[model samples]
Target: MPVTPGGKASDGTRADAGALAGVEECEEAPDVSLEALGSVATTTDASPGTVVPGSPAGTPAGPVSGTSPDREAAGTGSGRDTPVERLEDPGNSATERGTGRPGVAEKTLEQALPSVLADGPPKVLAELARAPQRSRAVRRDGLRRMGIATGLVALLAVVFCAVQVLRPLPGPALVMTGAPSYTIAGAPLTPAWPGEGEAAVEVEGVGSLGAYGDQKPIPTGSMAKVMTAYVVLQDHPLKNGDDGPVIAVDAQTAKESTAPGESTAVVAEGQRFTERQMLQLMLIPSGNNIARLLSRWDAGSDAAFLGRMSGAARQLGMNDTTYTDPSGLDAGTRSTAVDQIRLARAAMQDPTFSAVVAMPRVTIAGVGQIDNNNTDLVDPGVIGIKTGSTSAAGGNLMWAAQQTVGGSKQLILGVVMAQHSAGASDYGLAKALAVSQKLINQVRKALTCTTVVHRGEVVGYLDDGVGGRAPVVAGADLTVIGWPGQSTQLTLSAPVTGLPHRAKAGTTVGTIALRTGQAAGTEVPVVLQHDMTTPGLSQRIARLR
Candidate 1:
């Protein structure tokens, strides 16, 4: 065999018509020694197999003419047909490897490649070059599969993104809240309850304040007269300043008017009086006979009229009330301060009833004038309501007063019952008026003015159908009367047609109703604070992993 030092044949020619293209080749004629070819395969850079490129994937697959019978390897992974010849090493002898086989360590491509080619047939040279090309083709197929897999992964990512972008989202978080004060707080002082009786108070549009001790049913006395008047007005409704239908005084009522020890308005049998005048006589002077006379005139008899009063009580929401007679003179007619307050609230809403009760005096034909028994009506803030007194029921008064709060007249209704004195008959009514007047004055003073909510404050937010939101703000300051330490609650009205999405700055969405549990609430307009546009991914929907 003759081989070139440059990894090519000595002839500088291929072994046959077919040969390796780029790699150095060797041509052999017969049996050859590998010693001359050992140094030919090594370079100064090739000190070990680490720097060596792998041999042309070992020998070609089938048998060849040049290989001897002893040359085949036994199950060796290298794929070489023959046992490798050893390269010279300074530390070991040539046959140091067991079985005298070649060792891969310290071997370089420059040292090993030429010897195999030099002693082999022309097909081995062609196979050396062809084996590498075959390996390169396998790698090219693997790279093509990897590229297609990469493209599929990229396509899946794109599909996931498109689905997320088109998906629908729930509306934004919309809630209304007021600015809570951390330090600006104080509880309202309790109402001054009467020393010895049942009492309660209620502001118009506000709920009941509270009922004090022994609120169970008690005699209503002349307070029953108020209910009589309420029933009378209900049957024969009258507008203010109008004299209603006239009624002739009956013989029985005229006779009772002259009774020595009974309450009555002066009257003559067969004499006619208008309905308004009759009620004035019954309510203002507390004419007991007039009360009975009106009851008989409305219903066929007194018993039937009592049934109407009881029915009226139920209709007015007076659950703890009972009526046994047309007049409160019967102790069997029982009521609670809570029940009377309910009736008083409904009665005051009528103009004819309220006006008649507030009158100081009314002129008549025979009797020059009759003064109202409810003298407290003359007080500045005090208005028309009724008073009742009896030996059994003590003194009870149902009263209404007015005060200017936030430039609007606020009506207050109250009831004080069972004010009694063992010493004198007059003490009961006097004590009731005195106690109620004091409570009214205290309430008038305690009605403090404050700004509950400020304009442009973020009381809540309006949500879009997507995940976007805009601030729902108060459009104007809410300056109104409210008690100290009162907590305010807010509620939203349905948003205007297009909200959060099409909202503009200062556009009214709805009104926020503010309640303090103290008095009538004030309503403030809710508006958007800033203009809105499109929402982002995070705002429109939950974040995608």
Candidate 2:
């Protein structure tokens, strides 16, 4: 019995007996059994002892037709001589398996070597078993990076908030009020006394010289007309050269002008006058009737007009002044020289009043030109103001004069009240005029005007906070007038820690105020003389002192 390569019978019939013969032999040699080599040897219909590809070299050829090698060695097979053939190459064996060819078998050694050395599949299987631990390590690294980034952002946010809270805020710039001051070289000469009542003198830009007697209110007489004109102008404002609105005279005002001992322009009903013309008539001639007429025209009644006059007095800071009548005819109408000086200063600020009061005389349509009753108008440098006279009020004069002192025109305003006549033969007007003239002369001689600060001159220095200094200069020339031998003081106003860096030249940073005596001082603008640049960090730190 013969078997095929697939272990089937060669005659195409059952042959269990021949298959059992090799089984017993394989059992006897267990180490070299067909199962251990993963295949069994078989006989094919080829020539006897022919070797197949992939068979081990130097081993017995495939199954012999007559007797098998194992059976022959064991002396258990029928005797028959079979020739053996050499085995084919291993590369040819792999080619034969891949192609399933019956006889053709050819391949290179390089091709067979790869199949014998391949271990990729096994290595990939080993790595797959340990994948869980590697994945966990990657996840942990990502989380650590994210934590570090979040912590860095939070630290930067805290640092920003701290810097904002600790930084300093800038302060406000400086400011100045009032006027400048001047100094004199010698003691001022005092004026001679010639009046029986209170008298005082005041320079326009300077302070009051002195006052005599009590400051109690005395009869103002016709000086009350000054307030009358002031209130009228306030209600109907008139500029310096304006003719102002027309005011018609009423029949009732004409009747009042005929009152006994009252000064009158004798204005009749239906007469028309401009505001400027009416002011001249009332102020120049000291007309009581014209004053009352203006009062009635302004407030619709003399009483209401007097109320406005009292309010105007308080507004001008004249606390001691009282107005009982527009014309000052009432004995109750009284004021002090100090209060009158304040009133005079305010009234003269109006250009129309300043022009009208200085005139010696003026004419009207209804009445001929009347002379100003102020007798001192003829005196040297004497300007026309008002004059008042009565037995009870004595004589009162509010006068202004312009005199050259240190080559500048000085406007001197003086007032004398309750000046009485020496005897029954003379009038108190003479005493009032004499006293006012003497006082004006004394001020004109004692006071002098001087230029205190020149434009672009360095008035002082500004600290730059790092031990460096910058020049502070006046923006313009400043001049002031004061009595001889008076002391002048300079006050500076600026920022608390000086000016900031990079301040431009010509920028106003502060002010220089000059004070003389007890008067309100004047102020001049202070500016940087040159551009101030910011100091370097090292320079600022080094010059900390």
Candidate No. with top TM-score: 1
Cα displacement (Å) at residue 347, model 1 = 0.7
Model 2 / residue 193 / CA error / Å:
4.1
Deviation of model 1 at 319, angstroms: 1.1
lDDT of 1 at 61: 22
lDDT (0 to 1) per candidate: 0.69, 0.68
Output the lDDT of residue 502, model 1.
Answer: 67
Q: Once superposed on the true structure, which residue ranges of model 1 sit more than 4 Å away at CA?
A: 1-173, 179-187, 485-488, 495-500, 516-520, 534-545
Which TM-score value belongs to model 2?
0.62
Candidate 2 per-residue C-alpha lDDT over 1-545 given as tens digits, one digit per residue, 9 for 90 to 100: 55443333577643343323222232121122112111212212332222222333222223344655553442212243333332345555543443466554433321221221122123322333335556688999999999999999999977865654444423323323333334566766566655479887777766677787798999988889989988998889887488999988888777866777767777788889898888887888787888988998899898899889999999989999889999988889999998998888888878888888888877776788888888677776887578887777888899998878656676788889998885632248778878887787777767777677888878776666554556778888766677776667777687455666668888877778776544656678889888877655544435523
The residue pairs that clash in candidate 2, if any, are 179-521, 179-522, 180-521, 180-522, 181-514
**lDDT of predicted model 1:** 0.69
Residue range 232-259, candidate 1, lDDT tens digits? 8899999857878999988998888887
Return the top candidate by lDDT: 1
TM-score per model over all chains: 0.69, 0.62
Model 2 off-target regions past 4 Å? Answer: 1-182, 193-195, 404-408, 422-427, 453-458, 473-478, 494-498, 503-509, 516-531, 538-545
